[model samples]
Target: MDNINVSDPPARITTITSKKLSAKRAQTRIQAFLDDFENRNSTLKGGDKTVTVQLQKLNQALLDESQKRRKSAGEGR
Candidate 1:
């Protein structure tokens, strides 16, 4: 049997402190929220029309915000 010698130092840990969300990250979060809402209401046959409407509105707002960000980025470029 052969003994292997392994003595390697651990890699340094870098901590990132920031309060900014990228467009892609925001979009992903919005999509996840929408998906969660849909999944929760999937089993419910046909009740709570108001809640459904509100969800749709929120989804639209998310889409609009994302589009505005895209437009602004395009303009900047």
Candidate 2:
């Protein structure tokens, strides 16, 4: 009789490489900052106009960073 040997497959590994981690951290910090600012000024009346303008600027910055990260990652592949 021949004996058969079986071994478990190698474990799959998932890692958020340093670059991706840094980008995610930056995104979190930006979001938190925006949230805190909004919370502090919640009672200001008619402040939506100013807040909306600021939000637009922040959104654009976030969008640009996201695009830059996507482009960089694509180039790496």
Write out the backbone clash pairs for model 1: none
TM-score of 2: 0.40
The parts of candidate 1 lying over 4 Å away from their true place are: 1-27, 39-44
lDDT for model 2: 0.69
Q: Report lDDT per candidate.
A: 0.72, 0.69
Report lDDT (Cα) of residue 62, candidate 2.
Answer: 71
Q: TM-score for each prediction?
A: 0.47, 0.40
* Predicted model with the maximum lDDT: 1
Error of 2 at 58 (Å): 4.4
State in Å the error of residue 7, model 2.
77
